[model samples]
Target: MARLAYVIKFVADMDRAVAFYSETFGFPVRMRTPFWSEVDAGETTLALHPASDANPAGSCQLGFNLDDLRAFYEKGAVTFSVPPREQHGTLLARMIDCEGAEVSLSG
Candidate 1:
């Protein structure tokens, strides 16, 4: 299997996006640079890279499967899920990340 690495996002405003994700989702900033910033969410990382373009939809979503989906599902908030079903011992959902990139949540 091809192990998941990092998902890169193009962001015009890094500070605001970073603050939004950190304050909203509790993801920690793992690294930052002049052109990019990386945030850690569990074992996976999300990259917010500087982009000159204004539109950011063409970006792809990256997912990391969980061993315990119930914890996430049972959370008091965050009710958004894709397809809204469980199959093959996994649940799936898509969420917007710090940089407004689509993120796949599966377990």
Candidate 2:
């Protein structure tokens, strides 16, 4: 079976994107460079790549499971596209990343 490795997210600013994920999600930066970087996202690595015209920033959506959705949202680390709300008995929220990607969060 083929194992999944990295989920690439195109970013306009590598440093900003890396910092956002590291600070907001508390993910550790495994690798860092101007053109490419990687964050250890538990089972998989989230790769950051420089965006081009064809692959613009904010072209991807990422989902994360949080222990405290409200607390995470309250931190104000990133801008929220949608605030936390109950969905079918679970809490869900959407936040905009540094690159404007809408990240889904659930607790």
The models' CA-based lDDT, in order, is: 0.63, 0.82
**Which pairs clash inside model 1?**
none
- The C-alpha stretches of model 2 lying farther than 4 A from their native spots are 61-107
Query: What is the total number of backbone clashes in candidate 2?
Result: 0
Sum up the clashes in candidate 1: 0
Index of the highest-lDDT prediction? 2
TM-score on alpha carbons, each prediction = 0.48, 0.54
> On a 0 to 1 TM-score scale, where does candidate 1 land against the true structure?
0.48
What are the RMSD figures for all models against the true structure?
A: 11.1, 12.0
